[model samples]
Target: MSLSTTSLRSPRVVVIGAGVGGLAAAALLARQGLDVRVIERGQQPGGKLSQLAVGPSLLDAGPTVLTMRWVFDALFERLGQSLDEQLSLRPCAVLARHAWGPEERLDLLADLEASVTAMADFAGPAQGQRYLAFCERAKEIYDTLEQPFLRSQRPTPWSLAWRVGMSRLPQLARISPFRTLWQELGRYFPDPRLRQLFGRYATYCGSSPFDAPATLMLVAHVEREAVWQIEGGMHRLAQSLAALCQRQGVQISYGREAREILLRQGRVCGVALDQDAPLQADAVLFNGDVDALRQGLLGQPLRQAMGGRPLTSARRSLSAVTWHLQAEVGGFPLSHHNVFFSDPADEGYRREFADIAAGRLPAAPSVYVCAQDRTGDPMPRHSGQAERLMCLVNAPATADARPLTEEELLLCQAQMFARLTQAGLKISPSVHPLQRTSPQDFARRFPATGGALYGQASRGWRASFQRPASTTRVPGLYLAGGSVHPGPGLPMAALSGQLAAEQICAALRSTRRWQPVAMPGGMSMR
Candidate 1:
């Protein structure tokens, strides 16, 4: 349950990218008495978790909601830090507002009973019952996977089964890892709208509902457990964690890019930076997309470790076209989180999936709007001047050699706002200042990613297991971030960091070079 090793000097650990995963690993390893240094190319530490500015507006550029908060609690608790003390979080009363068309609107609430009541009123009594049952099923799947697949680092189904023990094998069927999430929803809700509603869970990992495994249903339970609105922006959480890392003696270097992963006899020894001299380290934890490692972006030598054939565009996840606007609100009352679904809902997703699959932007796409001003209440519009608002529409990955043209984007933008208006929501473009970020922009910012938002797409049934693991074949190299193991989203990304840290601790312990160290997530090494 503890790690022990003999060493006179502290082992220097270098983390690539200051994304949540890198920051988490750096913080935990530093706490364990390792000399940890984080390298980032950007001005801030959040990576994709950070905020962006469009003229006068500071908007959340990436993820908006914070769910599975316990993952963060466990992380900070390891360092004897309090998350509540460090950051201000407002629990979302209404998780998110969903609109299908002019007459159909639904709100998923933080309170499960309230959501069920809303569903009853929106759909029918039968749907309300089905929703309650779906919640139970979702929780069951979540409970079944929590300790084994999510928390533990296991490579194959056999390893996962071994960790779960023989008794828990039947529960695999309980989680229904065999079916697509969209197909599985048909069993719970007969309403196509409700099916698409719950099936939306697949998008949580940046995969299409028709393709992502039903195991993603756990996302529903994850959301129901907690959804907090970070007071300033989601990036504030990253800033807070970076500050804590500094307090723990972890050195953070920004505006410096990692050019190549220095290797010694097929094991990681250090990293070469773009702006500075090479940094020598006992081990390296990479927090960027594994694509960087495979594409030889770091170095040609590291490509073999990435495994598999070259990643094609077909393997990427759905990207998005985003709008960050400082505007005034009107029409339907805005909530903290609002999702405007495409009317003739089937028409929206069908075209979207087909277009993205064919590597083209969807003409009509579902839009997710985050009204930053309306966190707990609808802000009174004074002269229609409100703070920042973020509008996001799912798009194909940045696969085209040429960017999504302003012409193409203009068309998508027209559909985006149009869907909002048809769904009882309205925003005046003339009154607002907007910044558009196409998938091409995302790809440019995060290199080698086709602007695929949530790491790799979780496509086939085996994809859940196919993601790169924390412990790789390379002895001193490790992987973290949403793309690895436990899968995407804020909490999942943090867990990936914890897992990488645990592996590093275990590796150091086995080498007999460090003192006995107890791992995170209540895990202990023998």
Candidate 2:
């Protein structure tokens, strides 16, 4: 798996971006006795694991749930540290709440049996049994992919098949990579509402269920595994990682942008900063969106590093419009995570994707609201007090080319709140301090992305395999982040960092040829 030639001196590695991926890579490299430095443009760490201000409250503006904790545990364990000692996390009793209308609601509990019972009551005994069977299928798919696909380096279809071995090809085929998630859901649930609810998992990767492969059902199994809530917002997890990096002798330079990646004789040698002199390094790991390099935002020399690949707008992932506010809630008791579905007349979530595909805001988009101040309790800890809430709706990743107008944005906002009211969740109009973020804002925050939350849209089965590997065409340069191999989500992003670190360490530790031992499906050396 190693690529670089052995060097006599200790290697100096510079990571661009203080995201979870970058921070994770830096920590592992530092632990390996390498001199590691992280460059971040923001005032603080945590790229998308970020927060927004509302008076004295800092609401989580990016990812709200934490899953696949084992990823962090392994990272800390490798660094000779403990993840539990670093951050406090409480497992959620109620996974999420879904509402189809004022009187129709369902809560998926952490307990499988309890969730089945609840589903039976919501739909019917037969549908409930179907749900139970669906859970089993999801688990089967997850079990099959966890070791061979997720934990390994970038793998093509041929490599994945070879790793699975000839005996298990049927199991791989059953994962249903050829069908769309939305279509597959119809087989298990005759109830349209149930189909809509489960199909929504595709959005986790910033994709539409109608287009994303059915293989995405693994997301359901991931949540079923467990969802933990950070004691302080999710941003605290980022800060904790940054703290760990510093303790490991990794220097973090905040407020300094990486203007360009320095290359010498067709290989990476260092990073050029916008505010300071270039940093000389034996290797460079980029944890930001890959599009930034392809678009020449990081200098023209590395623009063709991706082989002048064209990332068309049609291929971009979904973006969102969000509202962060502190408001008093009344009807429809809240859970840690809640989703309010659009009426069936709105075409059962299909129109939402179609509108976005046409570069138009959805007229009746479903809404996801995160009650930051609530646990499993029916009411907020401080009853009647203004609770921190973040409401979001799916939108097109067209801010850079087809930005929404002020009038269009207002209409979109109005429709979002209306959907909430229809579900019987009421927020006091006298709410103090509400902030809104559009796709345009996101595009500016993460350049050359067009505001895509996930690196690229998981449009088909091949899409997952299409993500770039940790190693780049330029030697000594690597990639990490949601956009790279393994896919998006807090844990997946961290795993991508681990993959990059493993490759860098292997490459630097020796010049002897080594077979990839991380997993059977791991990438072979070039």
Candidate 3:
């Protein structure tokens, strides 16, 4: 059962979970001539990025907007392919619209000068200049940290120190890593409206701007770099990646849940499926929740260690309750993405995160609406003609025993509709609930404790290192995705997969005695 270095067998890589991370890792290893097998519990690939059928309209369940296009470009380039050849991406002129109250709207345009001018007109001239300055600082931080920390797997303190030292500490300090994002913005802009507007970026990683480090301002820079949407839907990107993996000679098994990480002696081994069959491998990369692995997918002896001192302590991020609506409305002044802010922004945010931490729901929650088919397309209606809408509200990630009652749903729906109507959206042609994913449902779907979208909350200075590394105490085990280093979002998760692949490749290369088995069409045998 031992896969010794001297053995003629090719390295077998078992990647659990068909998420972006798992798929990316499998594709990378397959390109390197490794025998890679992907096992997913779901009926199809793409964890959260999968598509959902709502009547005839196709809606993307996760990550509508795509940033960091270079990441995907690089991944495809590595495999001797171009992303353009596989899929088409359309650049959004208007990124998103933010509303403070009734008759108040601010559109974040793709053009920097236009956005700045809009801010000046809406808020003040000083706020506009401050935003420009913020963008510059964000670009600097992104450029300085991109290669050394973000692209690499297991960024040690020494590596970070060296990179920071090389960049000159003064420039690094200018990014304002000490203060919270909100605190830093407040320093630059006197207007409270401007601060609240920019503060919303913290939720990009499921964090509160009041608590996340000012370094997170890089999110704005990243977005400005390029904001795009897939031609058909975001899920098409996942489908393309999965297709690329299959074409590269990687084997994918759907609806096969990995029940255990079968270890031989104290080293790496393989995996056992729920069907009671063993799939052997030289290395095992888990793209599922790290907490699940630590909880013992193997059962028994594995269970003891799974609960043992966690490698990293994590604070769950805020969960959301999303309502997918199908309705008929004329003259809906909204793009693909829109946000409606409730009164007293700080009060609402505090109630959602802080009050929830103290065990309570927010008094007034900020609601976000994403209208996918606002352009008005004909055909495919439940009863008659209808459009698709995704309404989300920021809620606490507490696992309360109380289930959502029908009355609660009606009340929330009424409040959301009122807010939408007040914000200049005509919503009087009968709206039907196509689907509703609550905090409990998110928890069940993703198995994120308390349904926290982001793996851990980024609060204190130590929070950066709070993320677990790719490798664990168990020899062959490795982690990838939102839970691991570099954190969440589509781009970060993709980077995690690349990092894990690098680690696995490096580990195999170190064993010079092992030779890859040659097969036809650039494939390898295990």
Candidate 4:
């Protein structure tokens, strides 16, 4: 049963969860000529990036905004291909429009000078100039940290300290790793409104502006560098990735739930399906939430390695409540992206996290709407015809705290409609519940997620390194996902997959001989 004694050669990798991370790993490994199989519990692949049908229109269930295009480009380049051939991406002229109050509105243009000009018009020229200064500082931080930190899988504290120490100590102060994102903004802009506008970037990863570190200002650099839209929808990117994986010879199994991780003599051997049939593999790469793997999905042996800590047992990132509307209104003078801020942004955030902890709903919540499709334009139809609208509000992930009561659903729907009306989108449309992925639902669908979209809450000082590493205590096993290193969002998830694949490749290159151990009675070692 020992992996070292096994006579097998050539590692066969079985990846559980065919989401972005899993697919990315599978594609990379398969390209490396390893036998790779991807199993997904959902009816289709793509995990959170999957598409849903809303009447005649299609909606992307996750990540409407596409940032950090280089991450995806590099992935394709690694396979000796071009992303432009696989999928067409349109550069967005207007990143997003933000509304602090009904009277106060600002548009973040893709053109830096145009954005500064717009800010000058809205706030003042001084504020506009300050914004330029702020962006310069953000760029400095991004340039100094992106390669050594974000693009790699080195998460050990000592590794971080060494890297920071090597890069002149004064540069660390310039990055503002100690101050809150809001506090940093305060130092740059004296206007409260201007601070609030830039502060919205914190929510990109579902953290509060008041709490997230100033280092998050790099998010602005990422968006301003290149904001893109897929030609059809964000889901098209997922579809393209899936197509690429298929072309690379990856075996994808949909609706096949993995019941356990089968181990032999303390090393990863294979996986057991829900039907009790065991599929043997030389190594296992988990693309799903690692916390779930450590809990019990892979059975007792994996759980024991985690010291009985439930992955969902920890505090999670913010959850969202989204509504997909198919309405009859055309030529709507709305941008591709929009954020309608509720009064007192901090209060709304406080309510969301508090409700998640206590199991309740926030009274007033900040809402975001995405009307743009793959073309960075609205859906084309007859003039005055209704268009599709995707509305989302930050909410607690725990269903027990934010139950889906009939009255509560009606209230939320009504509130959303009223807010939309106030924002100037006049439309009475048929609403279809394409999908309602709450924090509790996230835990159910992504067991290791603990209802957290980004795996762990990025609140503390060590939060950056708090992201799990690819290598685990169990030999021949690795992890890749938003919950792991590099953190969440589409770009980070893709990076995690690449890092995991690199680790696997490195392990194989050093070991040379691949070993597959036998399972006794076809049961998990748990």
Candidate that would win on lDDT? 2
* TM-score: model 2 vs. ground truth: 0.95
Residue 102, candidate 4: how far off, in angstroms? 4.5
lDDT computed for candidate 2:
0.87
After superposition, the stretches of candidate 3 with alpha carbons farther than 4 Å from their true spots are: 2-5, 297-300, 303-314, 330-332, 345-348, 374-385, 400-410, 428-432, 515-526
lDDT at position 163, candidate 1: 76
| Better candidate number, 2 or 3, judged by TM-score | 2
lDDT of 2 by residue, 224-247 (tens): 899999999899999999998998
Q: Whole-model lDDT, candidate 4?
A: 0.72
At residue 368, give the lDDT of candidate 1. Answer: 87
Write candidate 1's Cα lDDT for 1-526 as tens digits: 1113245778888999999988988888888878899998889988888787767567888889798888888788887888898888888887887888767888888778888889899988888888889989899888888988888885588877787778877876787777889889889887777777777788888888989888888898888887888888898999988998998899999889999988777778789998668998888999998888888888988887656554677788878888888866677767778887764445556566777787777777788888877773333334456657889888878644546878889999898888888887766654545888888888877888878878888887799888889987877889999878888888888888889988898888777667644456433442
Best by TM-score: 2
Q: State the C-alpha lDDT per candidate.
A: 0.81, 0.87, 0.73, 0.72
User: What's the best-to-worst order under lDDT?
Assistant: 2, 1, 3, 4
**Clashing residue pair totals per candidate (backbone < 3 A):** 6, 0, 1, 11
Model 2, backbone clash pairs (residues 3+ apart or across chains), number: 0
Q: State residue 271's C-alpha deviation in candidate 4, in Å.
A: 0.1
What C-alpha lDDT does candidate 1 achieve relative to the native structure?
0.81
